[model samples]
Target: MVPLLVPLLLAATPPAPATPAPPRLDDAVPDTFSGVERVVAVGDVHGDVDALKEVLRLAGLLDDKGHWSGGKAHLVQTGDIPDRGEKTREAFELLMRLEGEAQAAGGRVHALLGNHEVMNMLGDLRYVSPGELASFADQATGPETSGSPRGFDGHRAAYGPTGRYGQWLRRHPAVVRIDDTLFVHGGVSPEVPAKTLAELNRWVRQDLFPGNPPGGAANPQGPLWFRGYALGEEQGAGLALDEVLKRFGAKRMVMGHTTDRDGKVRTRFGGKAVFIDTGLSTGYGRHLAALELRGGKVTALYREGRVELVTPVPPPLPIAPKQTVPRGQVSP
Candidate 1:
């Protein structure tokens, strides 16, 4: 995979200005990002542009005009851009647009890869952005002799190879690190070290993210897709501490993926990882939520929604069974 970082572009604000296309509690609009604040890290935004907007607004990232409200701080987006939520394409666009504006503002937008990006990267096609499904269907039908956007066979060849939409998604980053906290759409893979942010990134690249095989075995899954716990049988605290020991460095892991109710990342991993998923879409109708991290403290950032915790989950998932390292075999 290409290791190119974002271009140096955050010198000035993106004066191009985006006029929001009417709010519909549905899809995302260009101007929905208006007036953002300094540094804000969002959870799995599974295509809830409305919820995302609300959180951004609450975080003081958007202005009344609905532009990039974040002043000098950056925006952290944990992945899972496609699947489940309806407006995933818009969600991806939102990330890209935010990154672009961050560039112009001398600020940065950090987007970490979730399993969705990986699914999209390999052209799995099982999960797709609802917005572009029709377009993808059209591509799969081979060529249309009549309204070929360009012309006949020549026009078909002109269209970008490997399907434009899926092709576009491959450009996203698989992981992002903030201070000691490793930001991933999924949880940490057991095979990968949670010691340092750099070590984690290298593990993703070598064992999990791209390259496919770590010394010939299948690539490990990214954090978000890792639905189960990574440590032993203890409940929340055990997982938390394990995550802290592995990921949060000396601090705690502030992440989104597992369902969090009060915007608190609860775990049995020894206070190592704190989940922030907050089930933003909620599927039922309760609203979404986000966690605000600044200065060395943290707080809940919500879009004015409340979570009615009917029942707290008993025990978290069990720690993954140890994979036997084959004798005479080396991992990448």
Candidate 2:
């Protein structure tokens, strides 16, 4: 009674109501930049600097310096921003710059996170030797063979290092949800909700990246790189479109991890999961592939010539020399 005597004359003013939690990413971010009519979704952009430049050139976004030249078109990169190529740094920088430039030009560059990005963060994939990560990496690419700034691979000396860009990409979003279409580098796990994607990003950014991985299965390693099933590969896990849709709150989905039959962008999942990885790196001398999403439909595939397909040959797993731990001697 004595402890509360001082407040007897005043009704306790309720502490200011806790501020409502900020809106979830989907609620806060516009699926589409307001007023943009169409969005261009590009496939895996491994360290193909020349190919990146060409793609941007085709979209009218880059000139000679790999700068933003697209005045009004949205550019959606379907992940694969690192590894398997040399100019990963240049490509990452150009894309980051274009993100702002595109927005300023009444357009936008949506940098969707892909599996390779995750691998790079975990030190799984290597863009170049540790010492050469900065200088020897590839720059922005478009198609076919790529070129360097001073016009030679030796110009790598002038390009500096990959540390600048590699670090920035580690925190990038693994997937970008544009309007009703989920722009992802890899396929959406059969039934992840849009909130789950946001949750994963928040967890990684806030927990996983700072020497604090929240959990293995629920961590960035799982969602960003998991492709346990194919679109119609009855042999393994089948894509559950209904569940995938429920997770993203979208009617359709567009992903670019696996490839299609003709090695060009093809629609699959009966309009549910669209496979856009046409293996552009294979150098089959075919048309570069892409997709145009409009009104919740894939609308069109942008390639039209015989192109190459990077038929992935899954690498053999490393085997211990002789099961060093000895059968059941392994620690429990």
Q: Which predicted model would earn the best TM-score?
A: 2
Worst 10 contiguous positions by lDDT, candidate 1: 23-32
Candidate 2 stretches with Cα past 4 Å from truth are 1-35, 60-69, 126-163, 190-196, 204-208, 215-221, 228-239, 282-287, 295-332
Candidate models: Cα lDDT each: 0.52, 0.56
Stretch of 10 with least lDDT, candidate 2: 151-160
Q: In model 1, what lDDT does residue 297 have?
A: 45
Compose the digit string of candidate 1's lDDT tens values, residues 178-255. Answer: 554445565555555445544455444342223344511124444546654533356653544455445434444556
Q: How accurate is candidate 1 locally (lDDT)?
A: 0.52
Off by over 4 Å in 1: 1-38, 127-132, 135-172, 193-199, 202-222, 228-232, 235-250, 261-271, 282-286, 304-332
Clashes of each: 57, 30
Which candidate number has the best lDDT?
A: 2
For candidate 1, the clash count comes to 57
Write model 2 residue lDDT over 108-156, tens digit each, in one string: 8877666666555444434443433534434323222354233224322
